[model samples]
Target: MNEQEKLLNARDRFIDSMAKNMSLYGITHSVGRLYGLLYFNEKPMTLDEMKDELGMSKTSMSTAVRQLQELNMVEKVWKKGERKDLYQAADDWYDSFTALFTTSWRTGISLNMSTINRSLKELHNLRDNPETPDEVRASVKLDIEKYQYALDYYDWLNRFVDSLESKEIFNYIPKKE
Candidate 1:
């Protein structure tokens, strides 16, 4: 009903929205909340500040911070004369995307390649076996064609992800007015 209440409600809603969105991508609520807090405040915040604001234990907050840092979603910054580390959302938007592409995209492709590689081996064996029927051999040939297409796709994607330089991505992104 009051201005303060309205402000708090809006802030909480924003934090919840951020946390929910990040959770969809397997990130923790604590990291999401911290990112929301930093983005909304537009300043670095210390662990104690984030801990008090998010109502999380120090250890939880610390762990979340470390994960976020590893994911390039946040970075620790130093303030003059400050002994403690402060964190802010990554200034470069591409950092997070690059991190995700390099880790998640590459990893997923690698996993798929592993399965496909094994399947190809088995298919080869089936095609080569003298006991294989003509009809089955025809099907295996078709499957091999499809698998080769998929393998080529993955190879292209791996090279694409590798070619992506954060700087280049940032350059192509249109700047807001």
Candidate 2:
């Protein structure tokens, strides 16, 4: 009914909307709360303030901050003569989205590389063991080759992605006309 009450209501609505959106993207509730606070705050927030406002533990706040940092959605800031670290969202929203999507590809490449390495090791062991049936050995070899090809393809795709800027790629695509 009052001005302060209206402001509080708006803030709550903003926080709820942000939490829902971030949850859709697989972010935890604490992380979403932190983002909501940062999104509305005029200044960067300290961990203590975030913990008190979000009702989260210090460890939860720290972990959420670290995860947001890894996504490049949040960055650390320091003021002159300040002992504590402050955090804020990255400057560009589109760049933040790009960083988030890019992480999936990077993670995929690492996982695929590990799988390929393990398959190679298994193939080597099979070669050394005379008891492996010829048919089974052939099947495993085919699988290994398929994985290797997939790895190579992903490697090439990653290189291509790294080589071009997103803006450039967007401009180069022809219109539906």
Candidate 3:
């Protein structure tokens, strides 16, 4: 194959791999494909341009762009003479992965911690009640210990997420020289 053909083939392979792997992060393959397309584009693209290039409906393009925006994966940019909205993919892969990873992990940790805290509170009450059976109190104590351990783990995870956001994790696990 010619050099241009080989380059196109490599680009397509990258895009295909990106589309497939993005499903692990709860994103649709089509949306990941759109992100790959925008990542390789030299200039910001409009909804119409994306639709024409991807052969996707304008509505689908719009939805995909919105999803990307929520994830901080792409951003809308302005062209001084252009009226239509243009969007550029986040070009920094490290920052992009850090944002995505930290945000999702923090959210999950917060939710699980909240539920665990509530359950711990109720379990504590149950254990303290005089009318409760001894066997039941013993079970509640075990549960309380388990929940406390989970809370500690979540707290550690939150700190890890903080390090990721601050880029302090690189201090301990430096990138390739």
Candidate 1 vs candidate 3: which has greater TM-score?
Answer: 3
* Candidate 1 backbone clash number: 0
1-177 in candidate 2: lDDT tens per residue? 999999989998988887777776667766877877887778887888888988999898989989888877888998887778898877766666566656666677788888888878888788668899999888877887887798789888687556433545546663344
Decoy 3 TM-score against native: 0.85
lDDT of each: 0.83, 0.77, 0.90
- Choose the strongest candidate by lDDT: 3
Global Cα RMSD, each model: 2.6, 5.0, 2.2
Error of 2 at 55 (Å): 0.7
Give Cα distance to truth, residue 150, candidate 3, Å: 0.8
- Native-vs-model 3 lDDT? 0.90
TM value for model 2 = 0.64
Ranking by TM-score: 3, 1, 2
Over 133-169, each residue of candidate 1 has an lDDT whose tens digit, in order, gives: 9999999999999999999999988877765644554
How high is each candidate's TM-score?
Answer: 0.81, 0.64, 0.85
lDDT order of candidates, top first:
3, 1, 2
Q: Give a tens-digit lDDT track for model 3, residues 1-177.
A: 999999989998999899888876777899989999999999999999999999999999999999888877999999999999999999777677777777778778989999999999899899989999999999999999999999999999999988988989999998765
Report how far residue 142 has shifted in candidate 3, in Å: 1.2
Winning model by TM-score: 3
